[model samples]
Target: MNISSLKLDSSNTVLVTGGAGFIGSNLCESLLSNGNTVICLDNFATGKRENIAGFASNNNFTLIEGDIRDLNTCKKACSNVDYVLHQAALGSVPRSINDPITSNDVNVSGFLNMLVGARDANVKRFVYAASSSTYGDSTNMPKVEEIIGKPLSPYAITKYVNELYADIFSNTYGLETIGLRYFNVFGRKQDPNGAYAAVIPKFVMQLMSHESPTINGDGSFSRDFTYIDNVIQMNIRAIASNNKDAINTVYNVAYGERTDLKQLVELLKKYLSEFDSKIKNVETIYGPQRTGDVPHSLASISKAKKLLGYNPEYNIESGLKEAISWYWKNLK
Candidate 1:
């Protein structure tokens, strides 16, 4: 969908938790450019300052350096906000498996804190970063929002709990909430140095450094890797939509297509090779499958298309090309 068609009011104040992270920072940039007052709340545990450095000086942007685990902090951040885009949470399935307690505290408890704060503050709407991991062990192709399997890891459980809490808040207290179930989102500013970094940026960094990237499960696993701009678009639409049916429900935000790991590596090499010819020859290493990882994940974005009017502007190939260009210019 064209961004101009959304007709968002620039005078509104929007609070985006985790605003220094990849997705949150992008949202903040978009909102600020549109002349909105943007408040960013982050603890900097996983978020980096460099991601937000460029726009930090913008008059319309304000940053709150605090953890969402604190209820008071959440309340303070939500005060006088027109909309709340709650993107702060602990991500990564393996990280949750290794330390479930920390994950639950940050993902579940922190989410609850945000909900309560938003409800009490009387924000117009509360939108959050729900995960595709909530699909869990469901082997169904093109995963729909209604059909979900049992959660496989602590992270999945936490995200599912967020949905439940959102529903309860909506029903019990008359709060408006919308959940965006993001499927493998990636693009510029995505961290490539972390142990839990997503595949795209990690592979790009390894190939640029002439190191073989280790693929889990023989490179056959696939995912619906949505682009960052598309994710930003979904968030904007969620906040802008006034339809009652669209609120208080979840929608799958994706490009409605899947690319396997083997294909992903091939595409990355093809795009990155334009910057460095030797990158095409970079070999890949295969490792045992990761614990709590699903083999394939594809999303049915029909719900988002129908309800939110989401028309994704970038597919995997096009998004990867833009991402590669950014990495080459900034990191090379």
Candidate 2:
């Protein structure tokens, strides 16, 4: 079953943290499209206002300028909300390596605050952005939920800690929660400006600028680059799923297909060249692999498929096409 087939409860008021970021903003828009009231909380730390600019005038949408690291702000955001999609966090393996303490403060401490705030607010469900990096040194081909490797970086540790906190909250406080371990999610609104920007967005930006994109390592590292629409689908289903087996469980949200960095660049070039033929011959520069980076990642989404009925809507090619089109229109 495709994700579009899943049913959602439209009456719920949803609070989306980091709601101005790439995935959060997309989720907020989708929820509004489904006729749900969405309250977006973003600090503008990495989240941009442009991401949610279109929804500003919508009666069903509200934006709050705040950070998730603050308990008071989180408490305020959780009030009268039926569901909490905690997407706020300091992401990127390189960024975490550069500053582990800040990552811990935001991803771990901030996450706990949100969990506590949501529990006290009596929200129906709490879903969060877990990461594929949690499968850190595990040599497994298709990462599973039950088996996890030791976290190789501070970002990975923080995300893994979120799952731990969620479990303890469910067991001790009976606060329902779900964690979706997202693979390389990419699409529109993904910021390509920062030094720690994701591969897809950064590469897209560089290609648009007619500059050579850098490939870390030999460009052979593979990732299960899931699309944004698929992620939004997973969040909606995870929040609304009434299945007993689905609640309080962690699921891998991915396309279940891996594409190497070289292949990814080729695909991006192929698509971008159609818009500007100058990008057709842009060569890639390779650099020594950065620290805290994994060699490969793939997700086995059977758990989500069986329990939450999470069927991803787009594959790499299809998602990239959509993403590229959006960036072309908005960025250039």
Q: Which candidate leads the pack in TM-score?
A: 1
Q: Which ten residues in a row have the lowest lDDT in candidate 2?
A: 1-10
lDDT of all predictions: 0.94, 0.91
Candidate 1: tens digits of C-alpha lDDT, residues 1-332: 44556988989999999999999998988998888999999999999998889887899889999999999999999999999999999999999999999999999999999999999999999999999999999988889999999999999999999999999999999889999999999999999988899889999999999999999988989999999999999999999997788999999999999999999999999999998999999999999999999888999999899988889999999999999999899988
RMSD (Å) per prediction: 0.9, 1.4
TM-score each candidate. Answer: 0.99, 0.97
Q: Write the per-residue lDDT of candidate 2 for residues 197-249, one digit (tens) a residue.
A: 89999999999999999998999999999998889889988988889779998
lDDT of 2 at 203: 95
Give me the overall lDDT of model 1.
0.94
- Which pairs clash in model 2? none
How many clashes in each structure?
0, 0
Candidate 1: Cα lDDT at 91: 96
